[model samples]
Each structure stands twice: as structure tokens, then as C-alpha cells.
Target: MSPSAVLHRQLHQAPTLALSGEGSYITLEDGRRILDATGGAAVSCLGHSNAEVRQAMIDQINQLSYCHTAYFSTKPFEELASLLIESTGEKMSKVYIVSSGSEAMEAAMKLSRQFYLEKANPEPQRTKFIARKQSYHGITIGSLSMGGHKFRRELFEPILLPNVSHVSPCNPYRNRKDGESNEEYIARLADELDAEFQRLGPETVCAFVAEPVVGAAMGCVPSVPGYFKAMKAICEKYGALFILDEVMSGMGRCGTLHAWEQEDVVPDMQTIGKGLGGGYAPIAGLLIGDKVIKTLEESTGSFRHGHTYQGHPVSCAAALAVQRVIQEENLVENVRAMGVLFEEELRKRLSDHPHVGDIRGKGLFWGIELVRDKTTKEPFDPNLQLAFKIQDKGLEAKYSISLYCGQGTADGIAGDHILLAPPYNTTREEIVRIVEVLQAVLEDVFGELKV
Candidate 1:
């Protein structure tokens, strides 16, 4: 292998190169064209080619690119914040923009801690956090500590931040039993969370963090009815805050602008990224609720944490335009409508395949869980890397579909599920084509495996 290839590649076995892209297709330097289904980890909500968004970025560049926060805030920054608050309604009053989701998550954790301390709850006792198992918050130390993804945390275990605990996630396909009713299963999971709180001494818990719809870690799994409500109640019963990491599930990916809205609950603090900028710019932010802000305002008067590029003007401008497009185009409504279509079509195309185990998702975000045996729900051996094989086949079929690959969907160590999150404004034709290509690729790869 060349030195650059040997050093920079994430996967040693797979080819790595993105020469350029347009619309939903990415082209390689070798002149290969492929459809981009997952939008590079669900970030590209507006798709790869949007002339207006591109021009927005260019115009902002002509005006100004970067200005340090100490000097002044730009029009784009102010307008973006205003637009976000207006859309999110009165609950999310303040917006602190950052460069990426991990930054947003770190800021949220620090802000949550500061909020508590500022509120005179200086009780050193409330320093612990509770996150769900099989969740991915981010890769930063604080967020990483809060995440329970086994593979992501394996090497960093010893040095990871302390006081983060985990409980069973609301996974029905694998965790739910044959006879367990939905209500019964939910009650069982809620009881397990309450048990964890008691085990940790609720007073020591600062917040219970979770993805409103668990992403990446568990394959775009939305909670089975009433899960988030029950979780919010538990967090409230204790004095802990509720922090929702919507970095992957928020910003209209799940039909609503905020995934928490579907659950009929609001988080004390929420982290959002991905579609926030529509992949037009690198931007993410923490939506601060009234209580958390009030605590800080009354006590500290200022948040203790700050980032150099907390709210860049150009990035903000791009995101502002992105949000405006979503609102003006009625894209969230499109997401809700097409989301149902995508899921229904996915089921029609792949539900009965011999190796297809479970297909679950919400809005435009979906996952196809592959298995060796559907009857027993037995996943193929991890060494087989079934997800990557399918992804390669899909790419060869001329689609740039993203495979949100992860081990441990089955047991935190083995199993493969491919996540598909198309653009919110994706046309019905595009959805149909995406599923069709996926069906063709999956059948080909799995059929070969069978032989």
C-alpha cells in the first residue's frame, strides 16, 4: 500500500477516495458513481448538490468568513439563532453553536454540570450520570464516558471520565421477550432504570442522558411507545436533569424538527447536529431550556465553558439558509409523509428475505438488520463483516449508500445492521430507487454467502 493509503485509511481492506459528489451521488477518482443514502452519517439533509446552499456559502465567504467571538457576532450567527428559537418555540430560548456534535455534547455536559453548581446544588454528591447501554453520544472524553457503545469505549476504558453508569436500552427486537406485551416490556425497562437510579443513589446523579431515538449504536431504533415519557418521569422523580442527544436523530430527521416532540417530552438540555447544517457547514449546538438557563443566570451570570469557534458566521449563515429551506419548502412535512413511505417500501422489498431479521426505524431513518437465521434471530459471525460486504455491493451497483456499521447490535460484540437515512426532502422516486438498489445489492451479497 502507498504511505498515504496505509496511514490515512479507516478500513484497511476497503478502497478510500471521494473525488467529488452531486445530488445523491458521490463520484470516486476512478470515475465510479454511487448514490449517497445515509448522507455521510445522516448529516446531509439537503443532499450533495444544492445550488442555493452552495451559493449561500460562497456569498458569505465574499462578505466574511471567520470572526472571533470576542470581537463581534455576525448577521448570519444572530439570524440563525433567531430562526432556530422561533422554530423550536419558546422552550429552547438560547442557542450555543459549536463546530460539531462532539463539541456540542461536551458543551452540554459542562453546561449541565455548571447549571447544577450555579443553582447552589453545589452538593458534590450530584456528580454522576446515567446513560443507556448500546448508545453513542460522541467521541470526546465527557461524551465518550456518557456513551455505552462497547466497541467505541473498549480501549479508552481506563482513562474515561468517571461516574457514568448505564442501564438496559429500550430495544424490543432483541431485548423484548416472546410473550411480553409492549406495556409490560416498557414497565420492565422503566423499572430497570429506576433500579439503576436507586443503585447509584439518585442524589449522586446529575442527569440521565439518552438519544431520543437511539442511533448508530442500535440501528436507528425508536423507543417502543411511552419509553421516553417514562424515562423523563424517572429523571424528574429524582433531581437529575434529562439530556437528549439528538445529534443524529434531530433536526427533522424524525418528521418533527425535534425528536423529543414525538415523545411528548422536553429535555432540560439537548444536543443537535447533523441536519442542523444540512451538511452545508460544520455546525452543532445545545438547545438550553428555561430552567437550566435560569439557574445559570441567577447564579453564575455566564456559562463557564466557551469555544473559539463556538458560533462561526459563515457556518451559521449556511445553516441558517439550510433551516430556512426546510421551513419554506415544508420539508419536515415531506419527511413525515415520505418517512412512512420509505419504511413501508423497505418492508415490502426486504422484510421476507431469509437473512433479513428485523427492519425498524422512524421518519427517514431506517435500519435493515441482517441475520444468519431469522427463526432464531442469529446474526452472522462478526468476522464475516456482512454489513460492509453489502455496502460494497451497493456501491458497485452505483449507489453511494452509507452503511452505519457497528458490531454488538446483537450482543455488543457481534451482529450487523445497515442504517439508511436519506435526505428529508428526498423525492418518492429517490426513495423507491434507494430501496430498489438496496434490495438488489442485499439479495446478491446474501445469496452469494448462502452458496
Candidate 2:
């Protein structure tokens, strides 16, 4: 390959050029068609080349493409906000739209602080945030600071904000005690969070941020039962906001419109992305709960933040169309049905593999953790980069499949897992194919390792 002008994620390797995408597969410039199982980091919930979303964007462009939210609000903007708020059953009264999950998280963090500032009894010392270890929020400085992914944050640790602290993630596979029941484990985690708040001075913390279902950083790990509720109760006890980052798990990725729906807890504020626009356009937003809205209404009456394209008309139109299509086509239902099949197929095929440690997730999002010793639940050595190699092998011409790969599930440098988040409208046949391709890739990779 010739020297590339574009600076890709990997400096040494230029990725293959994609010519087009249709349904669940993308066509490469070289004529190879690879199945898109992970939707490019779980963003393409509607899959590739969605005709409805395309038409909606084209229609919106014909009418109006850009509008400054500071000056005007377009139809798509108002309607998208209304739709999202309605979808939340009015628990969230407003939406602050942005271009990506990182921006949304940044907005959520700022809003949390702003809410406290604008309250009747202002909390000047409430400047701190709490997130979870191995959890990924986003890449922006503020969002990255709140994130606890050690591997991703190591390089920028010196420059990252010092106000954010982390607690152990609600991962049962590794953290759960040998004989501890689910209730006891959740209570223990809650107690730990309460202790952290007290140590930092409860009045000095603004909010506790978490993902209802852990995403890329943890490879689709959902919390143990009652975990979110317990955490929320602790936040309330401390008079701190409960913020949920649903960037990777929301918009029906987890068989529900909101991943929190299944968790039985409503966050005081929530950030959503990925499946929101279904990859039709770059979009994400922060959903404000009634308490925050009330505070702003009584005090500043405005969120002290602004973005050039906070609610781009085209992006809003694309997201609105995607949401409408999900409803019309009952794609969330498909997600629920296909999720069961996918999990069943994954466990049936890979559960007994010598190197496969765990297979877990909900809805269409699933992850398979690869281990060096299944009996001991030991992760592969970081030097091996097993996950990346498996992902690379899966995309080869012989396999022609794509799987989302992640590292540091066990700690921050070891543990390998493959994430599968096929489109919400994915078929049973597609689920089977994904599992088959994954099984083949795993067999080949582990066979070569002689494990």
C-alpha cells in the first residue's frame, strides 16, 4: 500500500477502503464482502445503507441543512427532542444534543455542575465526580477523566482532571466472591460507593456516573441484579446526582429503548449515543431529569453551555427517522428475539472451548472472554494481543467477518474478549453466521497457540 495522507487510528497500518455497505455487510474496494457484526463499535443499529435514514437525511438537506441553535430551532430538532423525552415517559424533560458520545458525556458532566450552581442552596464545593473502573465514557478530556479505562488513560493521566474518582465496576465474573449471593454483592458495592462519597465529603461530590451495561472497556458486561438501584440509592443518600452513560448500550441495543429500563432505576441525568442515529449521522445527547430542569428553571433558566452544532437539523432528522423505523419495523423486538438465539449459539459452540472463559451480555450485545486457563479464569498475556489477532483473522478473506475486540477485562492490560453487537434488525440466519464465523476464528487462533 502507498503512504496514506489520512492519520488513521493505527499509525503503522492503513485500513482497507470500504466501497459500499448494504444490510449487514460492507463491500471492500477489493470486492470482498465482510459481515459487520459489531456495527463499527455498536453505532450502526440500523445496519449499513439504510434507505429510510438516507431518504430522511436527503429530505432534510433539501429543506434546511444547518441552523444555529442559538438563533433558531428546526423542526427536526424540536421533534427529536420531543420524541426522546416522550420515549423516556417524561422522566427526562429536556435533551442537549451534540455530535458524539464524548461530547454528550462532557455536556452531562458540565450540566451536573451547573445544576448544583443554579440551585437555591448552591453547593460550591460539589466539584467532584465518581465513575467506575474499566468503564469507558468517551475520549474528550472531561469524559476521559471520568472514565476508568486504565489502558486508554495511561498516556494522558498527567493531564487528566483530578476531580474524578473510580470504584470497582459491577462485574460478577471476576469480582463476585466465591459464595457471595447477588444481594450481598450488590450491597457490598453500594457500601463501597458510599464510603468513597464519605471519604471525599458527600457535599463535595456532584454526581456518580456509570453505564447501566458496561461497553467497550469491559466488553458488554451488565451489572448484577439490583446493582443500579443500590447505587442510585447511595447517590440519593449523599444528595448527589445519578448519571448514566448509555452511549453503547442505549437506543435499543440492549433489547430496550433504554438499558436502564431493565435495571429498574432512572438516572437523574443520562447520556445516549451510538444507536441513536443508527450511523446515519454523528449525534448524541444528554437527557435531563426533572430535578435538574427544575433547578435551571428557577435559577439561571439556561444551561451555561453551547455548541456550534448542538442540534444539527440533518443529524436530528436522521435520528428521528431511525427511531421511527425502529418503531415501525419493531426492530427492538427483533433484537430481543435474536439476542436469545445469539447467546444460545455462542454458549453452545464456545462454552466448552479450553480458552473461552465467559460468554455474557443482553439483547443483541454479547461478549466472549478468552482465557489462557479456563479453570483458573486467567486472561491471556497482554504481549500476545490475542483479541486483536482474533479480530484481524476474522476479517481475513477466508472468514470475511468483523468482530469487535477489547482488552483489559481482567485488569487494565490483560484479558481478551470479542464483542458482537449486530444490528437491531439482524436476522436469525445472520446470528448463526456470526457465531459460526466466530467459532471458526477462535478454533484457528487457539489451535495456532496450542492451548
Candidate 3:
């Protein structure tokens, strides 16, 4: 079948067809092999192919594919829930499974609202959610409303839900002034959030939602030191839930199972996805904290939100296997070891490039910001679409690197950056190869634009 046989995102061209995959490589229909760098938006933590995950899927398909959650609970669902909660200790006790990150985010928002309502703090006025600018929750209406990406939210602005406010993200590279210390910057952002809560009448706020490590929106930007701590303090003082959207950064992606773990603060609720099922299945989940669960249990007696595919048997089985692989193989340890190597290699190779501005990340997730002028930290013209150019060049170089395009790392609609989130179990050789490909691709593209 032709590529045009299926719907494509880039209306002008047909899509590439993949014939097979192995390890961290994908073979196109025409027999060209491309390294699966970025793991398809950082989802394939276990890489393209895993024998154990494959067997787990096959076994579950043979056993059962679907079951009504209301009538019966499957072993896979129950076991996956237990595994997730057990990893986080007693703070997290409930897990709500869903098919996609957006679905999980929707569930999390609803749960936060429901928890508040159940606590009788439902001052009806408390519906506003405070998210960080340059943040992305998901693509659904609810999650979409929570996001602050200018491009993603532009078209839907007319119909978007109201009462969602955005504050400056804790991005030191772009948001912090030249003379500011990390502490001062964090404090300033925290103060801004507190001011927003005050402006909204603190009591009228339901939650402050943010990606623990900014994901696709800002290209794997981690918070400045003490940012989350300050943010959590403000949330506590304002009586608002702290919701960490770890959908793209959690599940061992950042050298830790939970991104918030390194932040030294547990969120009231957390949304997780992508690496949750390691791209082995369509699965994502919300990790509910004890306080929120208790609020519902003691008041409403049940959550008001659920989906037909929530806790799906087959998806749960695949996720369970994925989790086991992450734990048993100590892949997260590898993420930490290799993440340092990846970042070092990136710095050594591209940090001095004329158009390369900053290289920053944690664990296996990293981002390279592209610019028009290094001294001015100026971004290329939006028309050039430098991120896409880098992506195309990488593809031509036989590396399937994904550049998460964002328009606001430098401002609200100008900066371009590329995120690299290779598999957790990637080797040193693969990391070197990825860096070589990226350097070549960037040199080729940036040279043409003369940035």
C-alpha cells in the first residue's frame, strides 16, 4: 500500500513506511535502517524490540484482550497497579490506568477537582488551574487547556476552557536574567505563582500543574534547583494541589522511576505515560496519593471519573512486563551512567558550534537549543523552522532523531530546540553514533542557513 493510503500529519507528502524493527533501529520499507533515536518522543525506553515484552503481549492476547472493569478485575491490572504503587512507597496507593497520556492527564485533572470537591472545599470558584508557560500536559481538550505552548494552543484559543493561568517556567537558560542567581530566579518564579494564586483568590485555585522536567514543549528542560520545592510550598500555603505531569519524563526516563523523586517533593497527584509501557502498548496512568484517595474514600466513596479502557487487561500486561524489564535489568542505572555520557558527548561535540546555544538535560533525556546568534542568544526566524531542518537532515543521515519543536524557549514564539531521549538501555557506542549523526546533521543544516 502507498503511504498516502493512511492519514498523514504533513499533508504535502506521503509518510515513510516501516517494514521491521530491531533493538534501537527501524528498517524502512525500502530496506534502509535508521537508528530509533529519541525513541519516538521518548516512549520506547526498552528500544524498538524486546523479546520479553513481545512474549508478554502474546501471552496476554491468548489469555484475554478485554474485560469490563466494573464487573471484574484482571490479574495484569491488579499486578501493574501494585507494582507502580510499591515503587513509590505508601505515599502513592492508587493507580488509574488509561490508554494514552492525554487520557491519563484528563483523569488526573478530574481526580484533583473531585478530591477538592469531596473535601468540601468545592467553593465552586476553585476551578482555576495554574500551569507554567512553555509547558505541555496533553492534547485532549482538558489537558490541552492546561498546556502553555503558544503554537499548540493558538488554534484552540477561541474554544479553550477558561481560568487556566500560566506563570514563567523555571528555565534558567532562557528565563533567568544574566545577573540572577539560581536561588533568586527560583524565588522570583515562586513569588509570581504566589501572586497569581493571590490574584485568583488562592481559595479559587484547584491545583498548580506542571511537568516536573519540562517535556516536549521546552525540550527536556529541567527546573532550576529549588524550583519545585518553592512551588510546592506555595501550593501548600494556597491550599491547592500540586500536580506533576510526568507523562513524558517519568517511569525511569530521567535516571529515576519518578521525575519528582529527584525534586525532593512528592506531588499530590501525578500523571505518567510514554515510558510507562515502554511503547510496548497503549498505556498510561495517574498515580494517586494517599491524601487525595482518602479524601474521596471518606467523602464521595468513589472517583467520578473512569474510562472503558481504564485498567485494560492486555495493556496492563504489557506495562507490567515493561516495568519488570526496567526493574530487573536495572535500566535506570544505565540511564544515569549513559545519560552523563550522552550529555558530556553533546557538550564536547556541539557546545561550541556557532548556532548551538545550550545543551542541558538529566538522565537519558536531553535537549540542544539552536540559535541564530550565540552571543545574543537569538533564535532563527520562525520561517526557517530550524528544528524541522535538523530533523530532516538527521533522517537523511539515517538517524531517526526527533526534534521537539517549540517556539518560546527564548521568547514566546521564536526559539528552536531539539530533544534527544534515546532508550534507557542504550550503549556507549550507540551514544557516540547518535552524537556523530547529530553533529553531522546540525553542521549540514546550520551551515546552509549560516546561523
* Residue range 1-451, candidate 1, lDDT tens digits: 3445454545445565788878777888777777788888999998886888888889999999898987799999999888878877877879999999999989988887777788765756688899989999999888899999998899999999878999998889999999999899989988998999999998888899999887788788888888888998999999889999999999999989999888989889899999899888889999989888888788868887788888998899889888988988999999999999998999999998888898998899888787888999998898897877887677663555655555678877688888998888788998998888788888778779872
lDDT of 3 at 86: 94
Predicted candidate 3 versus true structure: per-residue lDDT over 52-149, tens digit per residue = 99999899999999998988999999999999999997679799999999998888877877777788555556788999788888898998899988
Residue pairs clashing, model 1: 34-400, 35-399, 35-400, 408-412, 408-413
Best of the candidates, lDDT: 2
Residue pairs with backbone overlap in model 3: none
Whole-model lDDT, candidate 3? 0.86
Cα lDDT of model 2 by residue, 1-451, tens digit: 3399998888788999999999999999999999999999999998999888999999999999998899999999999999999999998889999999999999998989998898999988899999999999999899999999999999999999999999999999989999999999998999999999999999999999999888899788999989999999999998999999999999999999999999999999999999999888999999989999999999979988999999999999999999999999999999999999999999999999888888899999998888888888889889998999999999899999999999998997799999999999999899999999999999898789786
Ranking by TM-score: 2, 3, 1
Give the TM-score comparing model 3 with the true structure, all chains together: 0.97
Give candidate 2 misplaced runs (Cα > 4 Å): none
Ranking under lDDT, best-scoring first?
2, 3, 1
Note the Cα lDDT for every prediction shown.
Answer: 0.86, 0.93, 0.86
Which residue pairs of candidate 2 clash? none
Runs off by more than 4 Å, candidate 1: 5-7, 11-15, 397-402
Error of 2 at 363 (Å): 0.3
Give the 10-residue window scoring lowest on summed lDDT in candidate 1: 1-10
